[model samples]
Target: MSSIPELLAVTNLNELSINDFIALLLTVADKTDLHPALKEGLPEYFSGGEKLREMAGNLRQLRDAAATGNREAKAEKMAAWEAGKLAVAMNAQHLTMLSLHRKDPSLLNNIGLELKQRQQGGKSSVNVLAETPVVTAKHVQGPSGPVSGSIVVVISRAKNTIPFEMQMTDDPSNESSWSSQGIHQKSRIEYQELEPAKRLYFRVRYHIDGKTSQWSPTANIIVL
Candidate 1:
């Protein structure tokens, strides 16, 4: 049995291995006092039997791809694995929030908000918690080489006063380290500065009532 501290030590989901995620699933499964929502959803997301094995198999394939230097295969597996991990982590967070509120119903909304903020710490799972903004950009020939056309970002969640951030990167693989153009309150914007033949990657994040969403999937445009 791993100590609570050891499991809780996972500050970043990106740093967690497949095995660690499996162990977390097992831990959650063993808890008898889970909230009704978690109890119902646990089997689909984190069953100690078949679902666990399937995830392990996926991780194995990912490992094999990495060993063989298959970048595309590795990337696909990585994205799938990341998506699964986020789904599971989201459940765990919900369970934590449920547990806290069970002790005192007055702590419901505020605790939920706090747990949400903690979940967003990874940024990868921000979209899971908040609305994922769809972003698009286009590059066109201009007076000076090439320039980006309209950059539009949109999200239609139930919440209001959504904030957003636009980010750009030169390489698709380096989207994790993209530079932010700055935060914006609107869903659409246009800025035209691009170099010819250069491929630009773009993504956007929306904020729901001060909570930042996970960055949207990346969109790219090649300068003419």
Candidate 2:
């Protein structure tokens, strides 16, 4: 049996056939209990495959439509392509979780919990700008009445100076509405005076040197 990392690399290459992909998915799903690494990564791992399959289906449809030069079909295919890209991203995240699980099972619970909270907290809905590196707020606490505490953003890449832009958001989809911080140095972003009982959303976009990096999964902070 291929090791999980090997399988992940294969998936990354997009070389696996549909049947092979499905088989791997089934293997991961069925044998998660046996592999401690997989077990630890289960939450993220399991969530990825269906999305991959959906993306594959979309690509197939798009290819066919393109060959036929059907305008309406092309438009639909483009939409599917966009959705598929998101699905592939979710799968990539699962792969990252798996990698972390192999390094330390103890982190599995913590990482899983973080991922779950982010999903619940509305960060997952944000558009990921790139795969180079990502920063996300793990937790935020403010004063009892009207003070925003420190904002923590997790960086996925090797530690380095990653420039980021962050601004408050109410509409997650309105990326433009988010004010940019203008290439600040650091992975985590912070703001103050965000009052209690108010819901604050933030859109963060970051880059290294010139290449674009992953944006923070849209994060919401509620002061209490």
Question: Per-prediction TM-score, please?
Answer: 0.37, 0.33
After superposition, candidate 2 runs with Cα above 4 Å error: 1-132, 138-156
Off by over 4 Å in 1: 1-128, 139-160, 208-210
Q: Candidate 1 on 1-224: residue-level lDDT in tens?
A: 84222112123556655434433333333332333344355544444334534654566556556657789877877786776566556544544555565664332222112334454355644544555767776543459754444333343433445555566778657423455455455655655544566777787766432244566888886665
After TM-score superposition, the amount by which residue 188's alpha carbon in candidate 1 deviates from its true location, in angstroms, is: 2.0
Would you give me the overall lDDT of model 2? 0.44
Candidate 1 to truth, TM = 0.37
Q: Per-residue CA lDDT of candidate 2, range 139-222, in tens?
A: 454465433444454545433554444445555574333433344556555555445556667555543212233455666756
Estimate the Cα RMSD of every predicted model relative to the unseen true structure.
Answer: 13.7, 16.7
What does candidate 2 score on TM? Answer: 0.33
Given candidate 2, what's the lDDT at residue 43? 64
